[model samples]
Target: MGIQRRRSWRFILLFFPLLVFLPLLFSVSELHRNSKELDQDLGSKRSNKFDHIVLGPAAGEGLSNRLQCSGLEALNKTHLSHISHAFNCSEIISFVTVFAVYNSSQSDEKLSDLVTVGNNSYSKAARSMAILNTYINFIQVSMPKSNVIVLSDPASELLIRRNNVSLLHIQGDYSRGMLMLQRIKSYIAFLETRYEEHLQGKHHLNHYIFTDSDMAVVDGLCDMFHKYPDFHLALTFRNNKDQPLNSGFIAVRGTPDGLQKAKIFLQEVLEAYSSKYMKASRMLGDQLALYWVIKSHPSFDVKRFSRPEAFMNEIHGAQVLFLPCAIYNWTPPEGAGQFHGMPLDVKVVHFKGSRKRLMLESWNFFSSSGSDISDMLCLILKSGRTKYDF
Candidate 1:
C-alpha cells in the first residue's frame, strides 16, 4: 500500500508541470490565430483597394443613406484622418440598413396615388428618390467607394448605376413598408433572421448602419465615420421624451456579439409591440420598445444628443400658435403664425404624429446653397399654417 501511494504521488507530480504550461500554451496559440486573422483581413482590404457595401430600404421618401453610400464609394478624393484616435482605417467599410419604402421615380407627370400616412397624401417613391439623389450626388461627387447592399421585399426594386451599386431584396410573406404598429411585429422578427445570415463567417462587415426608410442622411456619414477607423457604434439622437426607447437611427459594430444583441432587442421590441392586449403592451410600438431595450439591457450604448444644438424648443414652448420650429411636431403657439423668424438650430427635422407642416409644393432636396435655403425656409413657414385633424 505504501509503494502504491508513492507511485500515484509520483505520477501526479510529473503531470502538474505539464498542466501548468498547457493553459499558457493554449492562450498563446489563440492569440496568434486572432492576430493572424486580423492581419490577413487588413492585407486583403489593402490589396483590393477597398471593399464595402451599403444596405438600405427601398421604401420611404429618400433612401438617403443608400445613396450617400453609393456616392462615397464613387467619389471621396481626400484620404482624410482617422475615424477616432483608437481605430485606424481608410474609410467606412459598409452602409448596412433596412430597405427604403419610397418610390424610385419622382416625375410629376408619371406620379399618381400618394401613400396616406396620417393627414396628407405622400408620393411615396419620388420623395425617396429626391432624398436618395441628394446623398448619391454628394457621395458620388465626394468619396465614391466600392459597392452597396440593400435589403427589401419583392415589391421593392434595387436601382444602381454601374457595377459600383448592388441591391438585395428579402421577403417572407410580410409587407414591411405598409405595416402599421400591429403588423410591425413581423418586421422586427425579420431582423433576427437577417442578423443570423450576416454572421455566418462570410462577409465580416466593419459596421452596421441601421436606418428606417422614414429617416434621411443629409450629411456625409461615411466622411464623418472615416474618423472612427475602428468605430464601435454610431447612433443618432431620439427626441421622443414620451417613450424611453428610441429606435429611429442606430449604428453599431459589425461584430457577432453586437449583431446578436440587436436580434435580442428586436425580438423583445416585437414581443412588446405585439402585446397590445395589456394596454401598455402597445407602448409606442417601435419607439417605445426601443426605449425598453435601453432600459432592460445597457449594451446598446445608445448615443443621445441634438444634431446642431441641444435646446432649440423647450417643452413649455410647444403649442398650437407659438410652435418652436419644423424641428418638433404638433401645433404652434397661437401668437406665432410662422416659423421663419423663429430662433431655430437644427440639421435634421422630424414630423411625428402631427402631419400639419409638410409643404404642398414638392421639394425634397431643400436646396444645398444657402441662397435657396431661405426660400425653402419661407416655404416651410407657409406650410406651418395647415393642421391635420387626425
Candidate 2:
C-alpha cells in the first residue's frame, strides 16, 4: 500500500501540469493561427486589386465573359466612406473625358446603325463620323487642356491618331443589349488601368467624365470638382418621374477612393439587369437601370432636386449629386416652336434620337474663334452634305 500510494503521488505530480498546460497550449496555437489568417485577409484587402467580387450565375447573359475580355475578372465593393482613408492619392490633378464609339459593320441591324433623315434612311456611320469630328472640334476649342479618350474600333484609329487623341481599342461581342451595357464595363476597365498607371508613377488624374458621342460640351467640367469637393458621383435628371435620370452624362472623381466608389456604383448599375426594371428599360437603354439603382439606395429622393435644380444625397456613405437635365444635359424639343438657340447656361447639348440632325444645324449657328471648328465645318461641307442629305 505504501508503494502504491508513492506511485500514485508521483503520477499526480507528473500528469497534473500537463493537464493544466495542454489547454493553454492549444489556445495559444489557435490564437496564433487565427492571427495569421486575419493578417492574410488584411494583406489581400490592402492590395486593393478589387478581385474579391466574382459574378456567379447571373441573368446578364455573357456579362462575365465580356468582363473577362476587358481584363477585369471582378471588382471590389466599398460599403464605407472611410475606405478613402487608405488611398494615397497624388497631388497632381488632370481631367479626361471618355467616349465609347463602336463602328458597327454596315450589315448590322442595330437601331443606331440606321438614322432616319426625313423620308429617307441613311447609314449612321456618316453621322457618327461627323458628330465625333465636331465634338472633338468643340472640345479643342472649349477645353483644350482636358484629355480626350475614345474607346472605339480599328476603323477610328486614323481619325483618333490624327487628332492626337488617345484611342483604346475595345473587343467583345457588342450584340443586342451589350452595345449599350458593355460601355459601362469598358469605363470601369479604363479607370482601373488609369489607377494602375497612377500607382506606377506614369499618370495622375483628377476627374473623369464619361459621356455619349452625340453630346457637345460648351463649357468646362473640371471646375465642378472644385465646386463640390465632397460629392463623388454626379449625374443628370430628365425631370420625368418614370425616367428620372439619363446615364449619358456621368462624372466621377479619379482618385483611388473615388474610383472604387464609382466602380461600386457602376457595378450595382450593371447588376440591375437582373432586376424587375430590365424589361421596362429595354427600349430606354440604361435609364431604367440607373433609376433602379438610384432608387435602391437607402437614402434617395426623386424629388430632392426638383426645386433646387441640383441636389446632393449621401449613398453608401458617399455623396451623389443630381443636376437638372435642362442645365447640364439639355435635349432640344422636337418642334421648331419649342426650339431656340442653345442657352447661355447650358453646359452640354444632347443630340438624342432624331435630334442628331439638329446637331449640324446647331454647329452651324454656333461660332468659335478656334480654327479647328472652322476646319471641321469645311470637312463636313466638302462631303457635299447640306441639311444632312445623304
Best by TM-score: 2
**Candidate 2 residue pairs in backbone clash:** none
RMSD score of candidate 1 (Å): 27.3
Encode model 1's per-residue lDDT on 1-390: one tens digit a residue. 999999999999999999999999999999999999999999875454101111222111232221111211312111222112113334444443345453444453353444433233445445454444433332332234523444555675656563444565555433333343433443344445546767675545555444443332222345434434333333333333454223444454456554555555455656665553234433345666545544454333323321222221111111001112222221221111122222222222222332222422213324332322333333333333344321
Q: Distance (Å) between predicted and true CA of 366, model 1?
A: 6.8
Candidate 2 stretches greater than 4 Å from native: 1-123, 153-159, 274-283, 334-343, 367-390
TM-score of 2: 0.61
lDDT score, candidate 2: 0.58
Off by over 4 Å in 1: 1-89, 96-148, 155-165, 173-201, 222-235, 238-240, 276-284, 296-390
Identify the candidate with maximal lDDT. Answer: 2
What digit string (tens of lDDT, one per residue) describes model 2 on residues 192-249? 7776776777866667778877777765555567778877778888656577788878
Q: How many backbone clashes does candidate 2 have?
A: 0
lDDT (CA) per prediction? 0.39, 0.58
Cα lDDT for residue 258, model 2? Answer: 78
